[model samples]
Target chain A: MDLIKVGMADLAVCKAPQKLITTGLGSCVGVCLYDLEKKVGGLAHIMLPDSTQAKSVQNVAKYADTGIVATIEKLMALGVDRSRILAKIAGGAQMFNFAGTSNIMRIGERNVEAVKKQLEQLKIKLVAEDTGGNFGRTIIFDPQNGQLHIRTINQGEKTI
Target chain B: MEFENLNNLQKDALKEIGNIGAGNAATSLSTLLNKRINMAVPNIFILPFSQVVELMGGAEKPVAGGYLQVSGIAPMSMLFVLPEDSLKLFLNILIGKPMSEKIQLDEMDISVLKEITNILAGSYLTALNGFTNIEFNPSVPALAFDMAGAILGNVLQLYGEVSDYALVIESIFMEEEKEVKGHFFLLPEPGTLEIMLQKLGVVF
Candidate 1:
């Protein structure tokens, strides 16, 4: 099976027999979208919640608002049906114990909210998610089976 | 300040900052441990966000990270990171007892780690202040013992809004014959480097 790796503030899309993976998501989130009929998948590793907060949008895959939309568009451009698209997100962990102390501390929660909000705005169904914790996660999405594999340092691997 | 547009002289200025800052930090650490710690002159790297995890020894590598927000006229993010064996050595020095590499840190250990960051961060900023007269104040250091990519990525995310490129000043600290290894990363916020450079009369 072919493997496509998505880096921070980056996105990738692939068809059947290809897999998408992103590693080490702390406050950042990894958005995985799979097409049920086409067996196509797209993954975006987003760093921030919204693009409006940035002075300039250098990379669309860096924010939840723009990154989700960009991922969906890329997936659709690959001939996947928008109606058949389902989302599974992982990461967006606090990664630290300092609660409510700074803006970056709360960014994990904000990114989760923004991603869900963006998915709703675009009318995409969020089928599964493993998010919001105090640990880091590495996720892999298989396009053939639409199974998202999540891994952590202390926590064992699980497929959602 | 465009990160890609920095000239050689501007880059040298950045390297000097790393040299002086790390020099001060190593002294504080040496005093704390009651042993001599040697640090090489730091490296100045201007890299894209995607390549940062690789800079930290890949995404899944375990690391003990100290994250701090440097707030002043020029806001920035600062980090002190140590690998597993290195962290074990560091904790062993602090508690005056052998620390197992597999053992998890307790609340008391976390406090010691956080306080160490405070000392290091203070020394770095003080050194920078002496150079550019920029009064950079560091916030309470936050500790994370997790994947290197996670801690490093989150530190980069502190000013993720406008940072397409990270200006990282990286320094390595070692205790006699490289017994311990640690890294200090001083990531100036977007445009902060330009201000510091201007203050130092270095035009790019």
Candidate 2:
């Protein structure tokens, strides 16, 4: 099976028999959208929660708000119906924590919230999610089965 | 200030800064561990955020990272990383304990690593301040045992908002006898580089 790699602050769309993979997500979120009927999947590795915080709006895939929309659009362009698309998200981990840190340090939680809000706004049902912990995650989405495999150090692999 | 527009003189200046910082860090590390740590000449690169992890071997490579957020004068972040396989060796040398490969790190082990990171970061920052006469205060060091990409992502996020590329100064160090190796990364926040260059009297 072909594995399409998604880099940080990037997105990719692929059909069945191909898998979408994003690695080393820490405080960053991986938003995976899969269309059951069309057997298409799109993954976006977003770094921040909002694009409003960005100095340049050139890379939409770097923020949860814009990255989710861009991924949905890419899936729709591949003949996937908006109604048939469902979301499975992962990552957005704190990675490390300190006492009395500010809200900005909680970017992981914020990214998860922002991505969820965006998906809800699009009226897309969020099927499953493995998020909000103090660990990094590497996720692989298999469009053929609509399965998301999350891998972490020390912790065993889990399919969501 | 665009990194690509940096002239050779500017690049050399940055390299020298990295060298001096790494040299001090090495000295402190050697004293802490009671071992002679040899550091290679620091290499500086201006790369897209996506490619920063490639320097650590790959995005998915598991490693132990020490992260510190620096503020004042020139805000930035610093990272100290060691490969998973070398962690046991590092711990054994630091604490004089027989740490096996399969043994998990306990709270004490993590604390030891954090203290070492703190000392090294302090030494690095002190050297930079001495050179440029600028002040930099670092936060308490944080430790993470995760993939290189994940650890680096935290530091890169500060710059992701303003620029697609990051300026990275990497220093590789090894204890030849023990075969232990680690990498140190210094990343200045957006526009901080300009301030640093100006402090050193390097225009443009």
Candidate 3:
């Protein structure tokens, strides 16, 4: 099976037997969308929750709001039915407790909320999620099964 | 002060700032650990966010990281990263723990590392303040043992909303005759560069 790597602020789409991987997801959220019938999948590593906070409009995959929309549009362009698309999300960890001391520090939770809201607005069902913790995660998504395998430092590995 | 358009003189000025800051940090670390620490010349780079992890030997490299947010006129982020193996060696030296290649860090170990990061970051900021005469204080350092890419992604996220490129000052340090090694990263917020330059009396 071929593995496609997604970097920070990046996104990728692939077909069955091709897995999507993103590493070291601290406060960032990884959104994975898959169509069971088409066996097609897309993954986005979104760094921030909103694009409006940015100075310039660029790299739609870097922000949760734009990244999710872009990923869905990419999936639809590949002929996957928007109605059949389901999402499995992972990451969005706090990574540090000091970040919880203030609202601006809670980027992980904010990213998760923004991602979910974007999915809801797009009418995509969020089938599974493993998010909101004080640890970093590396995630791999198998397009064939739509299974997200999450790996953390002390917690070992879990698939959902 | 866009990092993307920095002239050679500005880049050199940043490198010098990194040099002085890392030098002070190394001294503080040496004093804390009571061992001589040698640091390489600091390197300043303007890189796309995607390539930042490659500086630490890839996204998946197991690393222990300490992150701090500096709040002041020129806000920035500071990161101290040590490879897992190097961390074991460092801990062994710091607390007289028996050495093991793949030892899992306990709570006490994490605390010690965080304290070390705090002191080092404090000294680094102090030196920069001395040079530029600016007041910047570091927040409580947060520790995470994870993939290098992940820890750095958290630091870079603050800048991701503003620009695609990041100004990174990187320095590598090693304990003399020991296997302990670490990387220090200084990521100043955008427009802060101009502030720093102006304070240093550099026009750009």
* Candidate 2 local lDDT, B1-204, one digit each (tens): 887678889999999999999999999988877789999999989998899999998989988998888989799899999987778888887787686656577899899989988998999999999989888999998898888888888778878888888999999888857578889999988788999999889997
CA lDDT of each candidate?
A: 0.87, 0.89, 0.89
lDDT by residue for model 3 (A1-160), tens: 6999999999999998889999888889999999989999999999999898777877999988899889989999999998999999998887766744765468889999999999999899999999987778889999898899999777789999
DockQ of 2: 0.77
Show the colliding residue pairs in model 1.
Answer: none
Task: State every prediction's TM-score relative to the real structure.
Answer: 0.96, 0.97, 0.96
lDDT of 1 by residue, A1-160 (tens): 6889999899999997989988888988899988968889999998999999888897999999989888888988999888899999988888776634677888888989999999998899999999988788989999888999999888789999
Q: TM-score of A-chain in each prediction?
A: 0.96, 0.96, 0.96
Tell me which of candidates 2 and 3 scores higher on DockQ: 2
lDDT of 1 by residue, B79-136 (tens): 8988888888888887865766485878888899999999999998999899889888
Interface RMSD measured for model 1 = 1.4
Over 4 Å off in model 1, which ranges? none
Q: Using DockQ, give the best candidate's number.
A: 2
User: Against the correct fold, how does model 1 do in TM-score?
Assistant: 0.96
For candidate 2, the lDDT comes to 0.89
List runs of model 3 lying over 4 Å from the truth: none
